[model samples]
Target: MPRVGGTKNVDVAAVIALRPDLVLANKEESSQRDVERLIEAGLPVFVSFPCTVEESLDYVETLARLLHVDAPPRPAPARRQGELRVCAPIWKDPWMTMDGRTYGSDLLSWLGADNVFSDRARRYPLAADVAGAPAADPGARDTRYPRVTAEEIRARGPALVLLPDEPYRFDETHLEEVRSWGVEAALVSGKDLFWYGVRTAGALERLDRALAPHR
Candidate 1:
């Protein structure tokens, strides 16, 4: 069910054959090329980009309205669904993250783990900047770190480290290194995390199983 190829790719063709009533997708969530091609094919496609803390909520409200499922959930809507607190390291050497308003933050919102960095002083700051440079003194080198290191990971000790598999592309080599340090880590879909909807709940659960090994 990967977005790029195989069954998921074939899904587009199948859906086209049936001439469904509507097609919904997030601008930031779907592959740019694929979405573009679908549009070129004259499909009735609707796209939106939810890229922030506020915008993400707005996305849900808007999407629900589009699908005619916006009726008030019976009394307690919050308890009906679970959420993940994804931690997307977006920096270079030291690693960093975006604000509560970025697409990465939105993805982690449903990744289901508590984000260890949520309380950090700076938003989207270098790993060394927030956690300190390994063992450096608080008043000096820690303030100017340019990359994340083993010491930082050991100290922060996030419940699960979900790195992006694209843009930065954390691979097996990175996984091997992270495992060696006693920290659990894995790569997740940048799109799925960034572009989830009610239809994607199953996909998220699948993602949870995919990362179960690292847990």
Candidate 2:
């Protein structure tokens, strides 16, 4: 069934009514309170927190083992030419990006692209700084996905910008705007960059093709 909302806002009644034997949750996406509620109601919930690329791969294998299902062959991503300096924004309104510790960033590295903010302290950085201005909340970790500003993006001066399709859809309009800033930009599938396991192989191929123009 189509999940009406995100894991944090899933339909509890609908899920319980389905009478599923096991519930798969994520430490980052699913709330602890929700997991506990499901557990109290006699449901088994398996929570996963796959922050890095390798960890995400491991998470799938672990899940398969738990379910006693045959795991698919592991994906092997071909390495790319480590030349592009990339800035990938996942959201807008208050721009957000994947930092060094995130699965997406790891994927970017695996593809041979260097994330400009990989050394950033937060996994998701709030580019509160605009037009080379200072951040209003430099140390705020209130949300894993931090907010950013356009000026900050310019200041970072990345050679390329990757805009993902989900969490916040970055369409052609967004792509043009990024290009206007004198940086090469493209729309990318969030799943390919963020999802691991069976999807990793395809993601690698897609990313390679997407970045070919800039190479």
What are the lDDT scores of the predictions, listed in order?
Answer: 0.54, 0.77
Considering only N, C-alpha and C atoms within 3 Å, which residue pairs clash in candidate 2? 127-148, 131-151
Worst 10 residues of 1 by lDDT: 71-80
Off-target runs (Cα >4 Å) in candidate 2 are 1-5, 121-144
TM-score, candidate number 2 = 0.85
Per-residue lDDT over 1-215 for candidate 1, one digit per residue giving the tens place of the 0 to 100 score:
22434423435655566665667766444656666666677777777775543455566677677778863332211211344333556544656554454544544455445555555534233433545434434542222113444565567666566766655677788777777877677777665554544424444565666655644
- Clash totals, every prediction: 15, 2
- The segments of candidate 1 whose C-alpha lies over 4 angstroms from its true place after superposition are 1-87, 98-103, 106-111, 121-150, 196-203
lDDT of 1 at 20: 54
lDDT agreement of model 1 with the native: 0.54
